[model samples]
Target: MKKANKLLKEIVVLIFALLFLSPIYIVFANSFKDRGELYESVLALPSSYSFQYYLQAMERMNFISAFGNSLVVTAVSIFFLVILSSMTAWMLARTNNKLSKIIFMSFIATMLIPFQTIMMPLIQFMDQIMRLTNIPMLNTHGGLIFMHIGFNSALSIFLYHGFITTIPKSLEEAATIDGCSKFMLFWKIVLPMLKPITVTVIILNVIQIWNDFLLPSLVLTSPGLRTIPLTTFYFFGQFTIQWNLAMAGLTLTLIPIVIFYLFAQKHIIKGIGEGAIK
Candidate 1:
């Protein structure tokens, strides 16, 4: 009876998984179909698969440039987030002072506030800073990346803090006794030990920053600086509700992140599992 129940649960989960993935399957299938076939039947398999829509999407969206922009933004943002958040979290976790506790709590508090509430104010603030300093804060990749770091750092810091607390401080003491400086100790010992959580942080931030649309839309005005999501949106608009081309564009946009997730999925799962246990 237990085995039967387990089997039944597995079947149920499999059903739900397929149900969740059906939309993606539809998009992938329809991406290959022309407008005529898509209009006739979205659910049906394409009579003949063609890459014409993909080609059209690539050309219309300027996929290469958009992909490069997203890559640069996401890569730079994640790099800084990992370094800064990890160090901040480690300091907060190791220092058991009231101020550290309060600061860590503040970071956690910010996570409760919805991004939508601050979206307008954030844009305005950036604009004001740009006006005051005559700095290029809007319509620039650096500005977008900076915003991503600010918005995403809270969660990353929280995750790193939790993971850091689980690590033994005796190791740091041992390293100190051996004459290792704080900087060298953290770089050689603490940071390397944070591999699992770091992987999790990277995967999470990569997906969030790469697929971000609203933030990028608000920050990046230049057509040349658009990310994949923004480019895909403009492509959809230009195509005027052409579902085939739209789906093709979306499919192309999804390919890179999907590949990244596939590569890092094992580490993500492992990190989360260990974090939960810790």
Candidate 2:
């Protein structure tokens, strides 16, 4: 009976996996097809595979510019997030004061609140604050980066704090004995040891920032500055949706992330496992 149940569970899992992946399968299959072939057989392989649609998508989406923008935003935001959140987490983990504990709990509580709840207010504050202080936090790439830092910092800090707690203070004490300054100790010793959590933070933020639609859409008004997701929306209209082009665009958008995951997935898994072991 146990063996039968195990077999049944495997079958169920396989079915669900296929169910989730069917859309991706269809997208890839259709991407190589012309309009007529796509219309005729959305599920079937292309009569003869072609790259014309890929070329067309590249031209229409200004793939280079969009890709560059995404790269810049994702990289910059991740850099700031790692630096700021890791430092904050290290402090929170090391300090036993009541204020630090309270602050940490508040950050955890903030995570429970969905972005949608405060999104409108956030925009208003950015605009108003930028206007008042000349800080330029609206409808700009820099502005978007600032917003991402604020939104993502809490979660990054939480992850880093958890991982850092498991690290022994002996390392820091030894570094101090070697005449290491506080900054030097953190940069050289603590940060290197925090690699597992750093990888976790990078992977999570990359996926989130790369695929984020609402935040970018709300913050960036210029067509030239559109990220891949926002740019992909051009293929759809109120009356007609260009399914072929849209699918092609989506396929293009997924390529970088898929490639990233393929390469870094090892690191991601290793990091999570190491952190979990701690």
Candidate 3:
């Protein structure tokens, strides 16, 4: 009976796996075919496998530049996000005051608000600031970074705050008793202890900011500043779809993210597990 049940479970798992993978199979198969072949049979293997679509996408999207821009923006955003959020969360969790409570609650509240509702106002404020300060907040990488910092910081802080509360106050107290300064206490004791949550925050924000389209599109208007998603969009024309090339571009866009996750998969799982342990 146990053997039969195990076989049945295996069959179920295989079926569900195939169901989810069918679309990806179609994308891969169709990407090798020409436009006519794709229209005729989306799922059929190509009559002749060629890397033409990938080559075309690479040239058209200026692959190297797009890859570089994405790397720079994502790295900067993640750097600031991890630092600001982790530190803010540590402070908020350690301190007990009306101000800290209100600030923490405000971060949670901001997360509940939809981005679309604030899009126009955000753009206006940014425009005004640019005009007043001559900082060129619109149509620039810096603008995108600023927006990412604002939008992503609240979420990161919330995650950090939740995980920080699970840490023992005795750790900080012990550090203080040893004549450690407040900054030293955090850098030496708390930051090391918060490694799991920091990893969790990095993984989460990397996925969010890397794949995000709307905000980047709004802020980064120049073709030179285009990230992966925006670069993919250029493959679409007013009337033409270029499905094969589009799929190739999509594949290129997903590869970095996929590689990052594969390498960091263990840390990601451990971080999430530890973060939730409390």
Candidate 4:
């Protein structure tokens, strides 16, 4: 009976796994086919594999510039997000006071507010700031990254805060007695111990910032500043949609983050498990 139950559970899991992966199979399979072939049998495999559509999609998408924009935005945003949020979380975790609690709560509250509700006002406010100060807040990669950090900090801080609070205060106290400076205490002692949660924080934000579309769409007006998703949008026309090219574009867009997530995925699991264990 135990063996039969285990086998039944495996079968159920396999079913769900196949269901989850079906869209990926469809997209990748359809990407290699031409329009006529795609329309003829959407689910059927192509007669021959071809790189022609991929090359065309890359050309039309200005793949290099768009890819670079995405890399910069994601990398830069995550860099600051990790550093700033970790530090903020550490401080909040260490400081047992009403002010710190209030600040931490503020971060949590921001996460509760839906982005759709604030998006219009956010755009208007940024535009006004740009006009008033001429600091180029609305349309540049810098502005976009700044916004990413602001939007993402709460989760990063929340993760870091929970993990930090679990750490014994004795460690920081010992470091202080050892004549370690405040800066050194974090850099040399605390930050190193935060490796697990840090990796988790990084993977989560990388996924979020990399795939985000709406915020970037609102901020980036210049063609050169378009990210992968924005470039992929050109394949969709009101009248004439290029199914093959769109699929190829999607595959390209998915490749980097997919590879990244695959490699970093284990770390997320390990981190969570460790946090739970602690």
**All models: lDDT?**
0.89, 0.85, 0.84, 0.87
For residues 1-278, write the lDDT of model 1, one tens digit per residue. 99999999999999999999998889999998877788899899889888998998899999999999989999999999999999999989988999999999998899889878989999999999999998888999989989999999898988999888877889999999999998998899999999978988887787689889999999999999999989988887788778888888888987987887688788867766664554
Q: What is the lDDT of residue 62 in candidate 4?
A: 88
User: Which residues of candidate 1, in runs, are more than 4 Å off?
Assistant: 1-16, 272-278
TM-scores of the candidates in the order shown:
0.89, 0.88, 0.91, 0.90
Residue pairs of candidate 2 with colliding backbone atoms: none
Candidate 3: what lDDT? 0.84
The ten-residue window of minimal lDDT in model 1 covers: 269-278
Per-residue lDDT of 1-278 in model 3, one digit per residue for the tens?
A: 99999999999999999989788777778778888888898877889988988888888988889889988998999998888888898999988999999999998888889889999998999999988999999998878987898899887887788878876798789879989999998888888887877888888778788888899888888899999878777656521567788777767776787798799989877766654553
Q: Looking at model 3, report the run of 10 residues with the lowest lDDT sum.
A: 233-242
Kindly indicate the candidate among 1 and 2 with the higher TM-score.
1
Top TM-score hit: 3
Clashing pairs for predicted structure model 3, backbone only: none
lDDT of 4 by residue, 89-152 (tens): 9999998999999999999888889899999999999989998999898889999999999999
Candidate 4 wrongly placed segments (more than 4 Å): 1-16, 238-240, 269-278
Deviation from native of the Cα of residue 234 in model 2, angstroms: 3.2
